[model samples]
Target chain A: MSALLQLTGVTAFYGAIQALKGVDLVVNKGEIVTLIGSNGAGKSTLMMTICGNPRARNGQIVYDGEDITRLPTFEIMRRGLAQSPEGRRIFPRMSVHENLLMGAYGRPPAEASQDMEQVFTLFPRLKERMAQRGGTLSGGEQQMLAIGRALMSRPRLLLLDEPSLGLAPLVVKLIFGAIRELNRTTGLTVLLVEQNAFQALRLAHRGYVLVNGAITMAGPGAELLARPEIRAAYLEGAH
Target chain B: MVRDAGLSALVALGLFSSMIGVRMTQGDDGMTLTGRGGALAAVVAAVFVGRLIMLAWRARRPAGTPSPKRVDAGLSRIGRYVAPVFLIAAIALPLYGGRYFLDTGILVLTYIMLGWGLSIVVGLAGLLDLGYVAFYAVGAYSYALLSTTYHLGFWTTLPIAGVLAAIWGIILGFPVLRLRGDYLAIVTLAFGEIIRVVLLNWTSLTGGPNGITDIPRPTLFGLKFNASGDADTFATYFGLDYSVTQRFVFLYYVILGLALLTNWVSLRLRRLPLGRAWEALREDEIACRALGINVTITKLTAFAIGAMFGGFAGAFFATRQAFISPESFNFAESAMVLAIVVLGGMGSQLGVALAALVMIGGSELFRDFAEYRMLIFGIGLVVMMVVRPRGLVSGRTPSIFLGKRKDIAADLVAQGRG
Candidate 1:
């Protein structure tokens, strides 16, 4: 598989403190890539860096054969990268419909409705709460709406940061299943950041283990799942 | 109930003792202090009676018959019909009311327009702008300068003034792009003061504090609303008797048209994509960026559009007064306009008009009670904040809805920090 997004020696910082320490990662076209780490290991920082916010202080980020290391967040997003950010950053006052419309902001209106339909197909609960304010949605429903909103952009590379972060096991299973199904059916490229390492490894085609802002392990999902350290460190007490 | 009333009267006595009981009057000998026992007793008695009536009213009402939320909802529901009815009364005012009433109408409409203009920035876009008067000054000065320097007519200078103010909005927008909440307000407040100071100090161009006078009034397609005897005069052209009230009536309608246009455009803009982008920006800036919206452009547009309307109102003011000065566009004007927006409930256009009517028109009625007007206004605002923190029309009708239209209660909506 050809690499859709390639990051080399990527480092990011908040003032003097470094969040990403010379990390190298690759997300191939039509492949589900998972980045697993414990809290504060720069999993989210990595995702945000690729989106050009707090940007890569030193390194190269090539997305779809174009350098986007210094591009503005909105510009990078316009280049077919959509992020369902951590904590589900939905517009609380806006309706579900308006939130979806915002995701499809720069796209053609005619195509947006069709894209929205595809998102609704993935998460039907969103359609029921279409007129409801985004803030009023339950945690799981908000997660669904966040993913649905990201899908409205018809992005080539879907970057989901901790989709199952606070959800119940069943809802987590449902969300993971949707991501896996979407990848298989549409060949949609995904770079998922997760603290739920076991579920993530089981769902992803390949996985990277991050510890202390550096990748400690990289291999196929099943191969990583079988590693003793991976099982002990991430999956020991996690269901 | 008697206990509550007694407690209220006691508190009232403590509050009003020095204010009502004691007075200082300039007599032939000098300033003299005197006691007004009767006045103090009357005030205390009035407070006692007021508390008793309030307690009785509350006791008589059934429990939860009208929740605050229900009241807010009902008010907004009635607010729907209030607009057209108010418009009819406003349009018909010149027919029945004398010059005093018409003049008050003009003042009220001016504020209504200003309130609606600032609402776009503070309400929809969620940017707290404290220097809105900068644009107003820019507009007024633009018209005054053009009319005096280039002999441009009011009709010709109006759009020019608006464009100039919008440009100033953009100018102010660029520097404060990253500032939010209190920081943004401070910078905007500084910007307003800077504009006023410039107008005050620029002796050569702006005539300094002396101000520019003889700004011409608006004419109806080159026909002047002046005394009859000349063919170009409106009275002569129409073959009607000339009356000074005719000019006042014409100015009244001019501002009415301008204010209504401001309302119409603002209403239409709310339904557009640009408008939605603004509200989204207000709701969450980070989310807006993640959604690929150019935050810079959105913020600039809100400022520009809001400033444009302020500019329109300013130009109308200059033409109506036939004079322009920095004093007219001061911090107080900005505060008054912002207060109207807040009191009207942010983002609700009709709420703004009602607020302006009460604030400006009500203030005019209280002209005789100048000393107490501001005190009463302050108390009214405090009461409003405690009773209805979200203003009169707190619920928002979603610009776009699916299945059926529903008003999002104030609790669900996020009021941006601004």
Candidate 2:
């Protein structure tokens, strides 16, 4: 598979501190790529910069061969890129259906509705609670709604930041299972950011280990799974 | 005639008649029209009358329906919304009331237009504006100068006023695009005060403190409303009395039409992509920027469009008054208009209009309590805010289409509240 999304030498900063330092990553078309790291490892930071949140102070992001380093988040989203932000920044005041629709703000109406059907099929729990407010939903359901909302944009690349971060085993299983099913059926390219390295690597084709602000280890999911150090730090304690 | 229809009708009629003399001092032109204060009084009065009748009728036989209590409850619920309805009716009062009254109507319409105008910026976009009156002055002065110098008619000056306001809006929008919440509010307040001060001090072009008077009034076709209607003097030849009231009423409707047009346009723009962009900006500006919505363009459009309406209202004020003064466009006007929308309910079209009506209308109602009139409004505003933090019609929504909502009342109380 050719590269669908590429981030090279990406650097970012908050008011004074540097967060990302020359991070390089790639997710090929139709592949599930994961970024596994401990807390504050710049995984989420990299995800945001790719989507133009903190903005890349340096380096480049290319989506479908077009440089998108400085493009605003909405524009990147318009070009078939969507993110289910960490902590599920779903619009809390809105209803479940409205939150889902918020994701499709860039999609054409007919296409968005079609994608809505697919999201519903992927996580049927959301369908049952569509009328409930985003704030009222349980944690697992919120994550599912977040993922579903992102997909409403009919994104060419779906970026999920910690889908299993705070979810129960069943919910984690359900979300990961849905992610795999999406890749299998739609050939969607994914860039997942997770602290739950075990589940992430298990589901991903490959992943990059972010230590501090740099990439330390990169290999196939199985290879990363075998690393004693990686196992002890994250996966061993996590479900 | 609503449920318990028979009893409520008598009460409404009683209200409708007694309220006629409520204005007391009939202006040489006629009665004063709506303002936020005036609108509130009308609401209270209407409810008092309607409730009294409702109680009597209910005691006699209650609305002859299965859920009679619900119907009565619904009447009270609706009765509470007297401000919005009274304000809407006030928009048309200038037509029949006479010249002085029509002029007051013009004032009401000016605010109605301003409230709606700012609603787009502050309400929908969730931006707090203190400088909104600056745009009003811009449009007013633009209309005044353009009219007096160019000898342009009211219709002719309107577009110029709108364009000028929009241009200023763009200029104002850019500086504050980076700001949000209280910071945005302070910046906007400063912007409005700057405009007012500039107009006050800029003696050369603005005509400064004296302000431009004798701004031409609108004409029907080419015919002026002046009595010299000798063909050259259109008013005399028409066989109708050359009453200034006619001119005032006509102008009142013109503003009404324009105000209605403003409502229609905003409603349409809201449904389009731009409107959605504004909402996104409101919810989360950072996220909106990420979605590729140019923060600058969205912010600028809101300012420009909102200012354009302010300009329209300002221009109308100039023509209707036949005089323009700097005092007319002040920070107080801005505050009053903003208070109307916020009190009405942000992003609520009907709510904003009601706010303007109550605010403007209630002030007029206190014509009897002239000494304490302002205090009444100030206190009323405070009390209203405390009682209803969201607004008078808090959390009201727009239908995707323009039709009343369907009702299969969920509870008897809900039906009554309806």
Q: Is the docking of candidate 2 incorrect, acceptable, medium or high quality?
A: incorrect
Stretches of model 1 off by over 4 angstroms after superposition = B1-67, B402-418
What does candidate 1's lDDT look like per residue over A97-148, in tens digits?
8989999987888999899889877986677678888999999989998898
Please state the CAPRI-style docking class of candidate 1. Answer: acceptable
TM-score of chain B of each: 0.86, 0.74
How many Å off is the CA of B232 in candidate 2?
Answer: 5.2
**Candidate 2 residue-wise lDDT, A69-168, digit = tens:** 9886667778988888888776555567666666777557788768888997787677666666677799998999888988887888988988887778
Each prediction's fraction of true contacts recovered: 0.63, 0.23
Question: Candidate 2 on B1-418: residue-level lDDT in tens?
Answer: 3445445545654565556424455667877654344554565566666666646655665344423445445544775686467656766475457665766666677788889999999987777888999988888888888878878878888899999999999999888888888998899999988888888899988878888877887887777877665674456657776776667667777888888888988888877667766765776675554344567778899989998999888888888778887898778888899899998878877778777778886787678889998888887887776445667665433222212212222332353432
* Distance from true location, Cα of A166 in model 2, Å: 3.8
TM-score of predicted chain A against the true chain A, for each candidate: 0.99, 0.97
Candidate 1 residue B49 C-alpha distance from true site, Å: 8.8
